[model samples]
Target chain A: MTTNFSRFEGTEDYIVSEDLRNSVNVAVALSKPLLLKGEPGTGKTLLAQSIAKALGLQLIIWNIKSTTKAQDGLYVYDTVQRLYDTQFGNKDVSDIKQYIKLGKLGEAFTSEQQVVLLIDEIDKADLEFPNDLLWELDVMNFHIPETSETITAKNRPIVIITSNAEKELPDPFLRRCIFHYISFPEADMMEQIIKVHYPDLENTLLNEALKAFYWIRSQHNLHKKPSTSELLDWVQALSAGGISPDHIYQELPFLGTLLKKNQDFDTILRRVHNRGTGENQQTGTRIFRNW
Target chain B: MFINFFYLLKREGVPVSITEWMTLMEALSKGMAASSLTSFYYLARAILVKSETNFDKYDLAFSKYFQGIETPAQISDQVLNWLENSLPPLDMNIDLEERLKYQLENLDLNELKKTFEERLKEQKAEHHGGSKWVGTGGTSPFGHSGYHPGGIRVGGASLRRSAVKVAGERKYYEFRGDETLGVRQFEVALRKLRQFTTRLEGPKDLLDLDTTISETCNNAGKLKLVWTRPSKNSVKVILLMDSGGSMGPYYRLCNQLFTAVNKTTQFKSMEIYYFHNCVYDQLYLTPTCRQSESIKTEEFLRTHNSDHKLIFVGDATMAPSELTEVNGIIDWGMTNDEPGLTWLERLAHHFPHNVWLNPVAETYWESSSSYTIQLIKKVFPMFELTVDGLEQAVKKLKVRQ
Candidate 1:
């Protein structure tokens, strides 16, 4: 295989460093369980999707919820619909049996196609949520009750399970995964991301916004603030309407692209009010003594 | 003597206020006895400490404020021996017998076993006839993973005629629906999953399965497979999961993407320790979680390994001191220790092969983003999590050997 990520479907170039790339490739090729733990947004789920696309495998996703049961990942029995069918439509009684749809795990079991099972956001699931999977992934087969059949994977789907380190998983569960990382980007790359997001941004304004962003980052006090997506929005707002720093200061928190917390807005207001950091100002050089 | 570990949090320059600390304390005292070590550790933290990027600052303050809190009571030799050597008197909360009863009532393992064995027996008998497999009215004992009541798959419904014919002949044989009527049932039961049950045996059991399959795969010339744990989740996976701050124009999107990533399971298994203003020694957990991290990192890494990957999710544009020492990140004289950039050095030394991925574009790898690129160049490879980033990581791990 070429191993060029673009060759994979649904995956744009997931530009990671050399170690992470190799880890991802090894992860994709094998049926061995992959345990990826890192900071949030380090591209864990995307790796799974990338693998599924790279191989011509079915991408079977199970978005784990907090209330997810051990049985939730394996196979689901829709009792309500099944019982409903049983009471109303059972002319031959066997018709009632036909209506019980299998959940994600059951579907994975019965399907003949090679697939990639993306257990996305697995950490949010309860502690024991992973226990059931150890067996199924280990055996690559599960016994199907509806048919009294054991639908073993002729060739199992590549299992890519993701967790966000919300809490420590059990030791047994942790021991099962092959580890790797996806760290945040460096400054140059982020600037490129900015350029990509706001193609028409003037160099001066772009530089000013970029500098301001880095400066505010050094501020020790603030509630939850802007992320990469929010930065893109701020740039777009400025570039699109020629909205200067003035518009950003006045129209923000309402701009939908700027920030979430009142603290983030307050931070911006403090900068603008003190240092005169707005569009059309000379140099827009925020002269903060403390920041 | 209990104190808000949040005071320790300030050493790391975390902006955690008194309000968040009160909320954390309320959540703490509200709980019954501290059943979980990790929970109690966090509860005390919520009351005092606050730092973002510096793990070291938090640890220093935590020890100063809450030292010896986790240690159980010191017991004499005879009492300790008795507690260790013999079972304790039965108590409603802590008794072994009650625990067993709790397991049995909730799990119903026997019933589950019965269902499993009966299903196996039916399979072995090759009896996919229209007769009911287990219970009343020829219904399927099998749930979603079950066959039709007539033991037919809906797709196999075409072959139902043959099954019906077979059933007509054998309804007399398998249909002892009334268990009280003495039909010759197998005296044997299905083998228990205790073979596969991880707790029933030990980690050695894991090896046995490996070897057993190892033989078969070897005979077939197929590769043998084994499963194991990551080197790090138990080790500090200090997450610089980018929250929106002024790092650069790309800060907002990066934050959301990180947030979505935080909402996942795989990320949670590792010690999802976080940092904010410039990566440093004294880092904070949440606005409420004020505990600091300063275990002997060198001692930790002697065991943890350089392969332990350090993932920095911030834009990395600030002065390097914010990432290296305490004074740089506004570490307010909590200690003489350098708080900001020194932390990164320790991390780099510990996990020499760490990486930094900017969510920003590739073009910005120039003067504007010098600090980020500069930091990334140190102990590990630096790249974006774009196609190129994946390529670079592949290159590094391959050559690591």
Candidate 2:
């Protein structure tokens, strides 16, 4: 089963760590679903798109909600539509296959070329949703009782399942997939990620912003710590506002871009205020004002 | 091919099944690891370890197995050099090689490597410790420690191994669930509270297929469709939390649980109330337990039905009189005609589905001397405030009276 498939080295937009890259390649090579878990905004969903881009495969995303059922991903029998057709007396309603619409998973399986099928935030669905999809995922096929038809994959789509760790996925479902937890990037990796978003960001400003950003994240009392996406937005805001490097750490311009919750904002503000007071005592200059 | 490592991982508490092992083997055969040790570490982990919670254990097991292989070979060379040059003439009289051999045979290489790595990270300077850290003049595991079997002498010329360094990092320790629970984890656990009920009454949105088919047949060649509302989680929860004083330590934990319960959209309704030490005549709406935010317990019970799952979060550690005697409420201004125990019993009786989650450890409960905890346990099923305990409590809540 050693097929000559090009390995996913991450797309230009996404900067993947060595371990993550290896996990992706291994999952691809073995033709198993890659389960990506991480803190929110660590690019679990983006990785699937990156893989699709890198491998030149079409991307199929199944965004799961609380009401999402496993069967919905495969196919939906539009019985109401069939009944409407029968009542209106327009077209022949005898063909059951006509009303059977292919869903995201079904489309991915039926695609002429291989695709990247992203089951984004699988945990958003009900607890049993993953268990329901186990058979289809393992065999790359599903059976429709209405049509008495088995929809098998023309090409087994590379499956990428992302989880927010909201629900603990069943063990049997987990056993069938390759799992990787994307750790939040360190300062150096964050720099690369920042550069990916803002290519021409000034080095001094970037350094000062990153320093303050990391310092805020390190605070234990924060209810919701700012993540990578927030940092990108903050940097974008910084450059657009033409905020100077010296004022970046002192003023913390557009801090609302980073910390979302009022509690987190207050926590950071208090700490920064205390530090700024101490610095003022030493330097005899008001470095910060209460936001 | 690293079969022992599989058992090692299992022994280290990572649940590595045969199916996952087979997948890893297949990957290896396909050159997925690319003949690199680091890649193999990652590839094996990605395949065998399904959760980040087990990643730390996997690292330990991987390092133990691989480092064990490399340790003895390197140790022998170091031992030989130390035996020749480092040993004093007077000490040589005690058959040094024989002693060294015996010590080497008994020493756990895995333990030694782990201790060495820990010592290397922790030890800032020379200090006295008993065979644990890197220091002299004691039975320290590293750096010319006097008379220790598994001592790795520091300042000796040794080759730096990349694999050991990778394992030493222990990056995934933060993800371990043994510590305080994240809100997401609490939400996951709380999701079990969802008792979905498909009400016949209300807005008809979903298509009732079976009814539609039967109706179509009755209509005689005419098509008909049946619409009905989908099943929704109808479980209502009433949370009574013990706030202030002793609960100060568990403030963050309670907050997380509260956040999780608030975040979970599964429940039909959720009502939260706060109390100090134990519930008396009134329950406060806020954690501060102020008079302004108070609600009469009798009124609360009368309004809410017995179908609500009543959850009590408390340490349940207080003076026996507080639960037993009349006017035993902790607050200075407040006065209760009845004891705290009676109030608890009344609430428990009112809501058939009731559970008490003690922030204190379960082990402590068994040996607890607190009369209040024992008294409360009789009224409501007491469980520790942990992931497992919360899950069990949720299960207990779902069961019919």
Candidate 3:
């Protein structure tokens, strides 16, 4: 039987490229988890929310940490709490299910309506975590030993797992999901993103800021390049301050918004300062002397 | 149609399972993905690739099978075109036969430096398409984006490989030391050092149910359980890695090794340190740390026990002066009369078990005329940074017993 999920859930504001659209569609129709890899602040996490919002599904996020075990996503048994209650004598707490809590995965799986399950930064967990999660994800069911019950998905959750490439995921875990790498936006795309974020931004200032951003981004010395979110933040700062784009070279303090690392800031500040004092060249002009 | 794609990915060490391949076929059959090649690629990758680590391999295999589906490099052509300042067309008529005849071999680098300085003063406006002035597109002995054979590339991307010296503001991202060593071969080589012993109690004390059942059966069905914790290996590893400059080429490989060794259950303690070019007065815990705050080499030697295995992961390819000469630390201004070789010797003498794992091929050690490699070879036994080499090195450590 052909799986039909043709409804366009994403909005025009999401600004998905053809590649990303195909990836999302294939994920939806197949009812498989989509794995997104990208640089930090490139909106790997936001895509889940956007898709959930567009599809009118409840979003259940499982934010993973280094200590996060695979079982934590499905459910957590409060054995200590149960033991304390039994020993301290508050009430007759014979049933362990009273202390049992349904985790994000359980919540998503048990929901009668379709839900979006976001496993954010799955790489942060232990090496065995992804491998341990394989059976649960494949079967869409997990056994709760405490309650002597099993959790079967009433409606399969549209799973979206994100990774910052901090660690390599096990091959067995990766073989199950659909893979998509969200590329950092180009200048034109950046403009569209800015327009969506700040609709009232002037074209001239927008162009100037993007040009400066790209120039700094191209520099080889930066520890961390400013992301699109940082660019929007910088734009917001400029708009709030009522600073025109032409005087960007003069306004050095606001650069803190774009550059997070001290070394990157120092390097860019020196380059900008040198250009400001040494050459009266237009801000938009290429800085390369020979080219 | 997709079976070939499946086998190709598997052949490239992607670990694609038959079940996953069938799922991909099922998805494609259901018209879940669009018929376009790009759509098929995303669909295939999503179904076949189980882990993020193999994404690079999948992409490589995908491109190998389906040519030209991958997007061009993310750096836009518009940026490059805008950077290309409008210039006058090349005047072929300008008689530059006399000037162009100057051979690269005939001109000394020192003399060329002086000539470049003189031209730098004489050049006024940004000249383009001219033979006499330093600019783009013409036969200029200086400046980049021009047809210059054996000339100093001042700015712009490298057009030809014949540059004497490159002068420009180039940025370098510090190598991420946490990258995965994808191959399980390295892990297998690392496991040679695992000397496990049973511990009575720990956090994850695994119950030996089989042993317990057998004992219970012997004791007339009364429960007699056995609990044991996995023992950690006693071998402590001290990894001193060379970062920046010539070491940049082997950054990924070194990172893989570093991460692999870190993840291995064979090591009880693994301490990693970063050094640039040659091991001098100090070594930084992290790459970004300031030199002044780095752990002193003297204190480092005093702290670690002799039982700790010292592994120096560097090419040992540097200017001979950096190893043998006083005040030869390239970046640092300090001078020591003892020399870097002496420091290496002292460490080797103190720690009898030491191995220098060089990413550079052993054949290149002698062929490349690396004098520093010879000096380092004298201090510590060298091994090629490969699976076999690591196995041999680990074997050598065991042989010392």
Top model number, TM-score? 2
What's the true lDDT of residue A198 in model 1?
A: 58
Docking class of 1: incorrect
Model 3 lDDT tens row, A1-291: 354645545565676665576677777787777888888988788888888888888899999998798888889887556645754679678877888898899998899999999999997876668888988888899999878899999998899999887666776777678888777887877888889888998888888888888888887757999998898899889878988778864555499899999988877877777676895423442322110
TM-scores of all candidate predictions against the true structure: 0.38, 0.79, 0.67
- Model 1 superposed RMSD (Cα): 36.1
lDDT tens readout by residue for model 1, B1-401: 23455654565344455554554444445451135433344333323322112223444445345432112222123322222322221122335345444544564433544543455445422222223332211224221122232232211112122111111111122212222211011000100000122332224322344564666467574434454432212222344454324444554445443443344333223344445445444344542213354333345446555645566665666666555544565334444256555666677666654666666555676765466456555645666655445346435533332
Compare the candidates by DockQ and give the number of the best one.
Answer: 2
Q: Positional deviation of B391 in candidate 3, in angstroms? A: 6.2
RMSD for all candidates, in order, please. Answer: 36.1, 9.7, 14.0
DockQ of 2: 0.37
Better of 2 and 3 by TM-score: 2
Task: Quickly count the clashes in candidate 3.
Answer: 11
TM-score of 2: 0.79
| Local accuracy by lDDT, each model | 0.48, 0.80, 0.73
What's the C-alpha lDDT at position A273 in model 2? 88
* Residue A170 of model 2, lDDT score: 82
* DockQ score for candidate 1: 0.01
Clashes of each: 121, 1, 11
Worst 10-residue lDDT window, candidate 2 chain B: B83-92
Docking class of 2: acceptable
**Candidate 2 colliding pairs:** B131-B139
